[model samples]
Target: MCASFIVAAHIEQNLSIRKTAAIFSVSKSSVQKLVKQQKIEGNLEPKPRGKPRYSHLNNSTASLREIVAAHPDATLLELCELFGQNTGNWVGRTAMCNALQKLGLNRQKNSEK
Candidate 1:
């Protein structure tokens, strides 16, 4: 934690911000910014990564399930088309495939068409 370095250089050793930068191999602005963050946020650790974005197909899961259940033999592209027609929100083949997989729906053909 560079907080320790800032403490040692500025508080204990009484070094200037520029001297701390030179001694610690960090920029003076970095030290100032970190100190400012510590004062404002009351912590030195960086924020955690944000949650994943909601899927594009998130809104129409019910209609999607109805479409897939109604046409169990439809291909992914066909499912995309039907879902688009039914819900007015077009989804790509891969997105439709992924949604189907997430919903535990499979269209694995049994025999040659």
Candidate 2:
């Protein structure tokens, strides 16, 4: 942000884009982009680009942990079903597996020694 402000100030002072980039140790394209953004938004500060990500499991972590604790031998599909029954919202098998993995509760079948 400081770099952006300096770039904008230099450009406002009639400094060449190339010279501003050279002084700032940034790419010429970066200077150009910042100048363009300043022209468009009247500021060089970057704006958030996309919607924030949301997780269906955010509210179900405790329920998931309890379910896994109660059913250590449950399959991924079974866990997904149980989560749906508990939360009233069904999640995909891969999503449930990923959520479980994120919670450090990966379930794997026992292999013979």
Candidate 3:
């Protein structure tokens, strides 16, 4: 917020974008973006940077834990397939592994003798 205000003020004072960025120790692109935003919106505040991440596994954590408990020998791909079949929401193997890790249910591979 302070950086945006400073950039706006510098732009208002007839400072070039490069000079404003140098004075503020920010990137030239940041100064350019903030200046453009101020011109369009009459304010220097930036909107949220990126899209919010949506997780399909959030509501299925309990069910996933129960499934893992019931089938401890299931591989990650098998678990993911089962979850997709049960919930009708397909998730990748990486997401399934991460979800299991978050639930403190890390799978350990057995050593081949």
Question: For every model shown, what is its TM-score relative to the native structure?
Answer: 0.63, 0.55, 0.59
Show where candidate 1 strays beyond 4 Å: 1-20, 36-52
For 68-88, candidate 3 gives per-residue lDDT tens digits of: 988899999999888988889
The whole-model lDDT of each prediction reads 0.79, 0.81, 0.82
Shift of residue 57 alpha carbon in model 1, Å: 1.6
Please give the lDDT score at residue 13 for candidate 3: 90
Candidate 2 structure quality by residue, lDDT tens digits, 61-88: 8988999999999988998898889889
Whole-model lDDT, model 3: 0.82
Q: List the residue pairs that clash in candidate 3.
A: none
lDDT over C-alpha atoms for residue 7 of model 2: 63
- Model 3: lDDT of residue 97: 85
Output the worst ten-in-a-row residue range by lDDT, candidate 3. Answer: 1-10
Q: How do the candidates rank by TM-score, highest first?
A: 1, 3, 2
